[model samples]
Target: MAVPSARLALLLCLMIPATVASSRSLRKSPANASRPTTFFEVDRPLRRSSGRCSTLLLSASFGSTFNKPPATNAYSPPRCLVKAGGRASAISLAVLEWRAACRGAQLDRVFGVWLGGAELLRGSTAAPPPNGIIWSVSKDVTKYASLLAAAGKPTFTVYLGNLVNTTLTGVYHANVTLHLYLRRTPPTKPPPATAPADLVVPVSRALPLDGGLWFPIQSAADVASKSVALPSNAYRAVLELYVSFHQDDELWYKNQPGYQNGPFREVTARVDGVLAGSVCPFPVIYPGGIYPLLWRPIAPIGSFNLPTYDIELTPFLGKLLDGKAHELAFAVTNAVGVWYVGANLHLWLDPGGTATTAGLVSYVAPAAKTTSSKSADPVDTHYHATANRLVSATGWVKSSYGNITTNSTRTFALVYLLTFETLDLTIVADTGVVATDGAGGVMYSAQTHGNFPLGWVYQQNSLTVTHGLEETTVAAGRWSSAPPYRSLRTTQSSLVEDEEGGGKSWGVRQTYRYNATDGCYFRNVTSSNYSVVSDHSNELCVKGAASVGVGAVTAALPTVNLP
Candidate 1:
């Protein structure tokens, strides 16, 4: 069953462990001193770790494990080394820094990092050239203090499945370090700025942590889920999901499924048996997509650090707070082996309440509706498709603070039109999509506005994921293309994240052109062999649409984004 929501296509984005017996051994690739480390990814700004601090080497020489499939390396998170009435209690913040390098020559590989049982990072290794390539990434981990502060020493692990045969000899190496910033004064309640969720529950397969907890979905019928028992005092919840498409679903843009025009895919989340929400993922082009050479120094945008999506589940907390295990499941309908999906639930507890009373007011969500059309010529074929979905839910909870009501509304509008030139073996995929998500009656008011593929906007007003879920109120949509090309392709892209006084918005503005001698792609549209692509933002930008109307379709990029 296909999911009913269409939200992600250009900016949807993680990974989780395993133990398998295999003799396949890989020699580590030697680092090249001459090759300059190039390539970077987009991420939320990093916070300076000041005050008494602690650091731990999370993963070392990961290249050795890359060749080991379903096998993961594990380390227990040590108590913040600095002693001050107990380091965990004095801890004020945490951050993760990673460095990787590769030499010789090899295909790019995908990897993930897990802290405790929650997924922390999802990335693709840049394919190294003969000499080699190197890169680094830094992330803020203050949001996961609960996991790090656990006294049991939750396990930290990584899963990087790779290949190293005679034909592909490049080996990738990575080292990760965790930094803990602590307070110097007497132990105090964490400052509001450093406060995170009270609890974080991993929605993943139970332990063994083998190969690392990430489950795989071979097809649309395969739904990956977990059952969790919540605290009666929990008043709010937010589900953060990470997704990556491999195999048949990787190039979903060009997929010709059943009688559907273009391609269709959506991610859906369910609570207990009732559907909660869904989204259309952003078509992130990996570094190896469409002639990998083009991304030698600068990888495709969002390829290195795939962005994660947030689904507000506070409305469903009404039935969940009754105190029994509830099923939290995810499904990628229209997928083909395998789409990897993982998630973490951030929960907020009433400061002084032992239990809360709640009830679901109303709910409405239907299967997505889609239509298609096709035109055929003696040597060419063209396909056009349109999709729309809307979901609205309302609920209320009574806590020590009294009764509070929360309501939510989400909408997705998209149109995909493509052309297949058989003689030239060329394919053109253009996407014009817009989505809006919102939640009300929470501690903070937040919103996200924009479209997908080329440019979009995401803004959050609260630092605590459990209380303030971003309500994306998009007034416009975006358009991007991936068409087969010949030679000489130039791509540009840039991302901006700005914040002030607790109001945060990830202003993602990117634009690029892929022109080849073959005249196979348009100046405004992209040129690819199926995968999605993007470029720097300051250089160019297609006039984006202010809003996506129902059943709206446009033939050109200029029309997709209106002034």
Candidate 2:
């Protein structure tokens, strides 16, 4: 069974040593087995060292180990270096173990980091130095655990041999950054197809690091559609940030293990507006949904109180689609203080995944787009269900949880909003040529304020996961019901229409922006304070109930239609 929670994967590091036979052999271990790990054992004396803080570029073969499945050989073996660190650093690197390959032509990428500051005082090398040094990969994810930026939360290790007398001791750093690259090589012409069959599989296709829509929230965050077409499949999402505390006027950094609550707070993220999703409260996950990943801050709650730090969301590389476009809507809220402000929210959507020329950036609200140029108009939109029926004219709207963040108490909340830009008109139909609302002769109407693909949240995922004991299995609910909605697909149905037969079902062809409610408020939590600010929280006061004027319906329309 799938590990119910991504939390269990955190322990994968402790089980690494036994599976990883040596620095030369990168092997996959069994999920059910545990083994003893090998500590960093450097036998020789300080052969060479660097004065200024820096990272050691260790080289090893990318050849596959015996345990690896032969099928993986069809793909190029990725090569890079990983310098270990403390608990937090280890877990941080462990969580990001997947993105290790380079884009087309490149075979390696940065996989880990080494943090600087107090972290550099010990472990000396015979090399030059800088006052403060930090090693990191160059991208940012919406969540924490970035390698370069001070705002990220990661774990790292220090080699015992570097202890060198009383000046330094070997232990791990709670936070460590990593720098990675593929071995330098000149580009060559494509190999002949008539080459040995053994060579065909390994070089057949490139890794998915170049650019395309990627599922950042694998199981945690869910989208209405799973697959979309992009230029190439080699795109990747990279997140880089800095974490420092702010007290009085000084900035304090956390380089050791454990959690840093406050006083240390500088963070950021980068992503493709069309290919990613984020959950608030730092460490967020869906357990059984698509993404099982979770974030756990090293610092404890109630630690710091400085106001103005942010996380950067960056998209490493992605493929852009022609004719069709993707939308990334960033829904954010403040965790504490009065509000939250995040700088550097950038998106990169490369039609060819690789940035051959200078990069380009475009900003748009997060909404899915259809091929037709029918963004602002709902010419054909309706909702239908196989089992549910249109009974009364009671007014009800449908929605789902969009963006979320931490509250003043440092806890998180889930907020809801609608999709699309028009007020959907749900017309009640009676068993006849024309139906009528209670107050009308032959007209019925209820206004829907937003677009299709509404969002909602359920509490069942959290309760059992958090409170469940060691052995109990957590339970997840099925996909929740959509609002009183229907999309007509004339090609799929027969002449047997609704009992009232006044309208055919209209499918959601496109979605646009509509009025947002509650402006900004705490979701899921018990807090009663909801504040909106212009300068501090980035909150906009755009509010209006979605409304639409409906015309009289003629008797028995054969096809479903939108207004």
TM-score of each: 0.69, 0.18
Worst 10 residues of 2 by lDDT: 489-498
Error of 1 at 238 (Å): 0.8
lDDT of 2: 0.18
lDDT, candidate 1, 1-563, per-residue tens: 11111212211210000001211111222324576445554333345436635455554554445435433445545454434555444656577777788776677777777876788778788877666778877767667767766656566666777766777777677777787777667355432111466788887665563454667888888888889999999866778888888765666654433432236777888898777777777666677653343354556656777667777677788779877999988888677777888899988677668998777666667778877666656334555666766555656667764565655555565566544311001211222222212343233322343245321122221110000011122222111111112222222332222234432121111223322222222232221211224432332222321232223222121111101
Q: What is the Å distance of residue 168 in model 2 from its true position?
A: 20
How well is each residue in 211-265 modelled by candidate 2, as lDDT tens digits? 1111111111222221222332211122211121111111111111111221112
Kindly give the stretch of ten consecutive residues in candidate 1 with the minimal lDDT sum. 14-23
The runs of at least 3 residues in candidate 1 whose Cα sits more than 4 Å from the true structure, single-residue gaps closed, are 1-33, 42-45, 52-54, 62-93, 181-195, 256-262, 420-442, 454-563
